[model samples]
Target: MRILFSGTPAYGHLLPLLPLERAARKAGHTTAFLTHASLGDLVAPAPVLPAGASLEETLDEFHRTTGTNAAEDMSPATAGEFFGGIRVDLGADAALAAAHDFGPDLVVAETADFLGPLAAAHLGVPWASHGVGIALEAPLAEAMWATAAARATARGLALARPFASVDPWPDCLQRDDWKPSRDRITVRPEAHESESGSGSGAGWEAPAFPGREHLPRVLVTLGTIVDDPEALTEIVTSLAGREVNVVVALPPSSADGALPVAGAGVHVTGFVPMRLLLQGMDAVVCSGGAGTVLSVLGAGLPLVIWPLGLDKPLNAERTAALGAAEVVGGAGEAGEAVVRVLEEPSYRAAARKAAADIGAMPRAEDVLPLLTARLG
Candidate 1:
């Protein structure tokens, strides 16, 4: 069987599907990824077909069409509309072309890939939606699907709902309102283990900086695209003043721009492999991206989350609801939140429990029969 995967051009969307893609190939199915040009590195080993708009172009068009700033707060309705436009305008052509060329019996995609289901519908093939984090609640999912339906009709094709949903998120963390259509297969979150060591580290070891191992160490990272210069400076400086060891990962573009070095206690650098970094970290302060949040939890580390935008706020809520993390508003509140997570034994206990739950879910490769059954 040939299977094609499509997604938004971000690690948050693509990373969750990696384990399943590996599973399909291990079972001897031909697999390929269709996404924007910018996400090439994340989808390695599997052949990638370049798709629709560039990441920058998609963001610019979203900003232009929605008349909403990506930096500021917006309603879920606006998010739905902006992303629906992405499916219709940026992704459809490339996805259709890839589908035609690959001739897949099945299409499995990240939940955010609006184009995947549409393309599957056009080709009359089976498709499945893979959940990235917590399942979106009824209100949000319904609103987003409403926008998707209109977008599909405008292009003269009806939307094809997934034949099944592959859920990697733990059941306890899911929204109370989430209800799937009878065919939901759950897989364990792979955490950062799958992406680690892949050229990001290229076999580099964690450097032995003096006093780092002795102090109470905390790792802080806002994701690649979303960061606030002022908030980062405040968080790093505040943590440094507390005498805790701080390691921060900054996007390459802004690494030299604004973060003022507080002291030798604070270390600033580019991306650090989470597999290695988690070895020394007692706690995590992050922007609540799904991959980061699940990775930290899977490691049994408590965290403080300050969401910047997109699905982060919702991810934060779900994690905090599970008692594994504290959700803070900004950098000003981060220092205290981190302290609370460390001092409260319950938070650590809860995190460990979630880690065990994550470990208990079915592995991606174990679900081959479910994913490929339609072809038979």
Candidate 2:
């Protein structure tokens, strides 16, 4: 079967879909990824059909759709508009073109990628949805459907939900209100740690810090899109002066001298493979992005989350409610929070339980049969 995959330009959406894409390819099915033009290089070796939206354009569309300029103010209303805008402005025309040119047997879209469903509706073909974290609520889903309805009408098609929905969130971690109407196949969360190509690396030397192996190690990340370099610098500086060994992973464009105090205890770098870093770390401090939170939980590492905006605050709240993490209001509190997570054994135990729950979930390969069956 020829499969076409679609997602937003961000790594948070694209990375979760890779394990299944690889599984399809290994099973001798041809696959291609359709996303924003900015992420085209990241999908190399696998044929990339550009959606013709740049990262800035996508961000602008998001703000326009959501009716908010600040990421911190994201709400259900914004989510609905975001999905609607994505389908109408970002990926619809490009997806339609890919459907005609690629001739895919099925369309597998990232849950956030509305264009996949629109194009599938246009072509009268079967399509599937993959969820990175939690499922959408009724209001958000309805808002997306509203946009999709208009698109379908314009294309002379009927809007319909996906034939299958792939979710990576474990049952325990899922939102209480999220119950799927479609066939919900749960997959384990796997972290993709590289900037380009198939990110399968697990082997990496721990960041060089002298005699620091004895001290507890804390990993800090703000993700790629969040641009709070000052906050990141403060967090790293606050921790480096403490008893713990600190590793700060910054974005590619982060300034070389971002951190104020650099010593043997703190190591700063641009994009270390997550699987490799998690192997040696004792605790994590992050911006509460679902991808990072899940990765930390999957590794059984207690985390301290600084919720900046968007879905992050909710992710932080849920994880903290589950006892796996402590959410802080700002970066200043992150240093002390990390200390608490390290000293408290209960947090570690909770993390282990979450990891066990994730372990009990299905792998990406387990979904291939269901996907193929749906195609038939």
Candidate 3:
């Protein structure tokens, strides 16, 4: 089978689809990734068919056209316009052309990426929606569908219902009221790693912060998009005074001197893959991106979430409801939350339970037959 995997250009949108793409390849199936050209590196070894503008370009266009910031205004209508309206308006033709060239038998798209489904419908091929983390709230989903439908209508086509929804979130993390509209295929979520291991920080060595070996180690990361040097510095400084050793992961764009001077227990490094960075970490302090949240929980580590915007607030709330994380309002609250998570056994226990639930889900390889069977 020729499987075409598609998603938005950002890490949060693209990384979730890798496990299934890798699984299909492992099962002797041909697979290609379709997304913005810049994100080709994230899905290395799988040939990337360029489609759509870069994420920055799309966000800029959305801002210019709508006169509203997506990050600041995360209401259903605004998010829908950003993801389904502007993104598809800018990229649909490119995505459709790429789909024609690839002629895939199946298209697996990350949730919120409308181009993949649009292309699939145009080609009369089946496509599946792959969940990024928890399922989208109903209002946001309906708004996305409404906008995407309009785009499809303009192209003299109509959106086809997906044959299945590939979900990686375990039941423990899912909302009780929200259910998928199609067949739900459960897949285990793995921390994304490129086949070549080139960009994944595979061999990067963690510095041996000498005397802090005995202290509990915590990772403080705000993900790629939420880079605030001042906030990071404050959080790091707050944690430095505590008993934990802090490993700070900054985005590559952040300069080495961006943060203020720190204690010997604090170590700072540029972006590293979650799989590598989570090693030896007892807890996490983050901005609660879905990828980061799922990765932290999958590692059985508790979290102190400082949600800035977008889907983060919902993710943080759900995670806290599960008792696996503590949601903090600011840098001042972050230190206390981390300390509480470390001292309290309940948080770790809940995280471990979530990990066990994730472990029990079907592996990507195991879901291949189900996807293939849908073609019939």
Top candidate by TM-score: 3
lDDT of 3 at 201: 81
Best lDDT goes to which candidate?
3
Q: What is the per-residue lDDT of model 1 for residues 53-109, given as tens digits with 9 covering 90 to 100?
A: 866677787788767664454356765765666545877887788778888888887
Q: What digit string (tens of lDDT, one per residue) describes model 2 on residues 227-314?
A: 6678888898667567899888776446562556578888776655577778788999999888888888999999999887777877
Candidates' RMSD to native = 2.5, 2.4, 1.5
Model 1 ranges off by over 4 Å: 70-76, 193-199, 252-258, 374-376
Backbone clashes in model 2, listed as residue pairs = none
TM-score quality measure for candidate 1: 0.91
Global local distance difference test of model 3: 0.87
lDDT of each: 0.78, 0.77, 0.87
TM-score of each: 0.91, 0.92, 0.96
lDDT of 3 by residue, 1-376 (tens): 8999999888888888988998899899999988988876788888889888888898789899989888688789997898889999888999999999999999999888999999998999889989897788789888998999999998998998788999887788777677656599998898865566345686778778897789999999999787789899889877867998998889755766346747789888887888988989999999998899889999999999999887888889989998999999898688888999999999999999999988888989899898788779
The TM-score ranking, best first, is: 3, 2, 1
Q: State in Å the error of residue 246, model 3.
A: 0.6
